[model samples]
Target: MACRCSPLLLPLLGWSALLLAPMLLVQFANAAIFVDDRGVQHTWDESTKARVAVRAGIGAVSLYHMGMREEQLAATWGLWGVRGSDFDPENPSQGSIYPEADPSPEEAAFLASAVNLSPSCWKNPRGCFQWDDTAEVLGMRDEIDFIVNIDNGSAEDSYNAAEEAGMNVIFIDTFYEYNENCRASNYSIIDTSFCYGRSMIDVAQRIEELAVFLGVEVDQNSLNQQKQAACDAAQAFTETMKDLHDKGIRVKVSIVDTELRDDTGVTTASVADFDPIELWVPRTLEELGMPLLHAASYENNEYGYIYSDEYFPDCTPGFVNDTCNGNTYFPVDFWLIDSRSFILIDDNFKLIFPDRAMLAGQYWSYPRNDGSISYVMIESLLNEYRTRLGSAVKLQDSTGTCTPADPKATAHLVADGTGGLGLNEFICYDEAAIQQEYLQCPTVAPVPPVSTPTSPTPPTANPPVPTSPNTSASSDAIMVSTITSIAAAAVTAFLMFCSTSG
Candidate 1:
């Protein structure tokens, strides 16, 4: 131990010691000492930290309410065991009581192997405070070192029961109450008006705090980056929509529940059917500078009526009278059908507004609240706008077209070959029969009137050739060829002049 080193090695050893000091400090920092709500302190090294188990109800509801952020983070980091159940909406109590009926094998295995802190409740003939039975049912009674409970009337009994069973209890109500108080103090009246419940941001912040309380290391930087990316995508989409609007290429869209079709197959569901918080799609579009048709009128309607109950008694709300007040709100450039609706409703909408486009699928589903608007959803919306609006612009530039006809004047219900009445006749700019029937055709008097006349009829016997949009590609190639030839000739002449001078 007393062996001497050379003078040259002394500096190298000192430098090595300086470099290793922070590494040793980090190793020591990784050992966490967490204090539970009961004033009980627990220590764990890096290898044997406590395992977490989220209640089954929390996992089920968080999917639609909080975007499943907590579950996703836990699964990705392998820090927690998730309890899942086969949810039955008709009999909701079955899911909360049963642990063996879990549908996901992966989740079940995680719960069985890694659960040491149980934050769950069970119901019986008595009530929901049976913590010992819940722990035994979840197969975590032997291994569970702590029981986390909410400090509310609903969970106070459960906390006492767990403590009576000789287990430490940690109350999580302070985290939730703190966030609620912060929101009340900081949020403006308008901001509070938009909020339906605890927002995704609140959920995320609470999760981060809970992780710290449980001595779990979370990738907070990565989570913030993901959230920032989503906000950036939403902002980019808004800017794109603003640019399109400035170019006078406004795409009017209407959200309809096609499931509520009338006898004549016309959609009876209007903006009145949905609550203010559920109208996230229209609200987001309006925020992005793209106002949806009839949304404002419906929002501001004095009587809060959008459709008549005379024709659609089954679908209309009970407050509606027998008068059609919102017949003029149907015409729009495109329709966004509710995801719950039938696919055949597309035909019904086409018969009513013949020139309009439609997009359907789960992405266009109803109840589009704050939790539903993710980064992927924003990207999808941007793609739809680009595809639909780009095609319309290209078509209009090539073909001199007018605005679609008034739906009220053109659309009519006619008797089908069968005994039923169906939506049959509608006028559109593309329809040849409607064009000939009108004294002034849309081709003759194009909407947003173009300066160049694009009439097929001319004074000469031989009509002039019509220019197709495809010709631009060939024209560009020809111009490139001409420029290349001129450049080659100029270069050759300059070389000849130099040779002659020499």
Candidate 2:
């Protein structure tokens, strides 16, 4: 009457459940999504179908001046950061020094001489004063993330517009043009032409007089106020741009003898009170401590002196070396936008570090008065960086598809080759692109469905007739019981016999 048990059934049911549970867990984990504090979400290959896309942008100076409408600016330069100065109520157009309808012969003569002597001077006199025209003629409006205007009065408004459009802006100090007489042409109210007409010492004394007239502290009987005025004007400009800090825009100044504080009243300690120093001058290859170098046009051959070379040897034109030998403090604001500065570094990097490094910078960033060599230089540099760096990060590119030659390393991206270029030295973008591409590519092999094993069919239920059993079940039980009883009785009898014998 005892129930018969089937041992195979228990194991079959338990193992089937165990295997199924793990499959379900894995599928659930694969389906989950996570996001970061910045609102950037992480997506796995399986979940990235509709969400994955590219970002494109540009970097230009005075972006609005490029004839790009607010919407166009947004579409082209939206992803980069915002910068530049606000339009000045005092001088609208952000210190844009356009030539008056006509200038005195003396003034025109000085400007002509400067244009001829200064390497940066435009071949055409009228072309230099036309920002909008330059932008149109150069076809720059269509290219760039945002624009950075140096000592531009309209920098803030331009930056705000850029921010709204999702672009970045930069404010360069006037120091880059301080030594250039053309600055007076750009800012005619400065009376630089008259000052330059005198002896250098007399000019210096006149400058001191002007600074005193402006109510700024100056050396007793010294005429260095021109320098002081330029510095003060720059400091004021920086302060004005710094107001946008709360809104997330960046402002920067350049290194100039004026910006360098000999005035004990405004020492380096107080310098931090204003805008943050953008670039540290005296940049040396040995001191960069970085694997990649970003070069602008002026950094190219013979044009290298436009940028500070205190840490490099031979600050002279066309001479490229590492480190500036002198110990003067150099500010790095304008260097970021100076096209000439990039050219020198570009050639230097190519010649020396071709195996490991590359350079990138803005193309068509400003309204180029002369279009002679920018396009050719830009393409050459781009190709050079790509070929040399192989695969490295291009911080400026939005596509993020740019990859290195080697599949294992990172590559740089240039979102819009028109506006800016970035040196992704760590190959950050290359590695990311590879991972993304790998995850995105469809598998060639077909995935087979998981098969559930079935239990083998048991024998038919028909009872087998007693082939040789001889009706054993009925008699077998009775015989087994009888044998058990007899064994027990014999044991009892033995114990009794032992007791009697004792």
Candidate 3:
């Protein structure tokens, strides 16, 4: 049927069509139909794809989602950045992860670019797992183009709602089963192999798949190369550690979370309660031919819970009673007497264990479970072992105190400083003391700040000193571009609407 417009409105309609043409063309170009890994077909609009929300059961998965993104803006769910008491004890939500409550320029730029969902989630009843109001409270249901759901159990309803709302849902691992490497062990925590190995590989593959779904071209070769390089490095580190063990140089180490202690000592709370030795620490150490000190000495199957007089023969009756009741401090002194070195997860142990054991290093200065696992973490652990084994010296005489104040101890503590115990703890290698050509003990370079990422990108073999970019200018440019686009669209729509009306 032919429809006729008023003679006066004909010119207006023509102008309106002309104005809408460019925007319509842009929208049409961005629209696509593709199938996700789940085999479900989806139609995507470019406007919707610009914003993404990740709802993964595990923190690692959420981090992988963001790290894999080339340019898409992600809604950050978990905490990222430094350790220390940045938050108020009474009000947990009013905290910043940055040191001195200020983000470094680089961090500020990154945070500005991403959407932080953490604050909103913190106020919610169920936190990040809340599904019913997730879309509304996160401000994501209408704002986001896609919801990356990893079958975290609580998000099924949210995922369904999103799909119904015409939002593209990228569902990965519907059943959400851990890989065999993680599940094979009866450890309290997921195996480190799964953390750095299988999980990363899966994420990498899914990232490539996501790119295809979005019609975005990624450098597959470059990603593959990075993956291979990381794997090779891990393998080499393991092999080197094993070789060191074959040489009869046993490096006994323990992983402890000192933050769990109240006045008593390693309390049975949160991460402190579990024995990391039972997980990857001992397994990896054993594989590397290093002796597991705690496992070897303590006969009890449960390492954290020190029950029965058989484990603590020297304790008084009151001490024994407290030990059996799980109120006693972790037997740090007993463990460290034989074991010369240990790795701490928290900074609280500086005073307690300093006189007992030499601090080898600290791990996850920024929370470990919050998606901090990476190939670089594995490399860092191996490096710590290498440094400790090569540089360890006996500063304590029969009296068990640092007499004569070893210069090397001060130098090592200062160099590797991650809130390390004061200089009086243990002796380490100086330039003259280090016999190994590869060992770079007592380094003169300033130690990295405590706020450094847990799994920072490993420096190149001969790394050049890095220079910071003009992040402020870069951020300004992005803002300007976004504003310009919005203004242009707004003006164009208004002009077209005014011209079309009769």
CA deviation > 4 Å runs, candidate 3: 1-50, 55-71, 82-108, 120-139, 150-168, 171-199, 215-217, 221-225, 247-314, 317-367, 372-502
Candidate RMSDs in Å, in order, are 26.3, 31.5, 17.3
Q: Write the per-residue lDDT of candidate 2 for residues 289-363, one digit (tens) a residue.
A: 112223232221112222222322333423322332222122111122222222233453433211111223211
Task: Estimate the overall C-alpha local distance difference test score of candidate 2.
Answer: 0.25
Q: What is the lDDT of residue 469 in candidate 3?
A: 62
For each candidate, what is the lDDT? 0.35, 0.25, 0.38
- Sort the predicted structures by TM-score, highest score first: 3, 1, 2
TM-score of candidate 3 on Cα atoms, chains taken together: 0.42
**lDDT: worst 10-residue window of model 3:** 333-342
Answer with 1 or 2, whichever has the higher lDDT. Answer: 1
lDDT of 2 at 411: 18
TM-score of each: 0.35, 0.18, 0.42
Model 3 over residues 98-123: C-alpha lDDT tens digits? 23222333333443355555564432
- The lDDT, on a scale of 0 to 1, for candidate 3 is 0.38
Q: Which ten residues in a row have the lowest lDDT in candidate 2?
A: 269-278
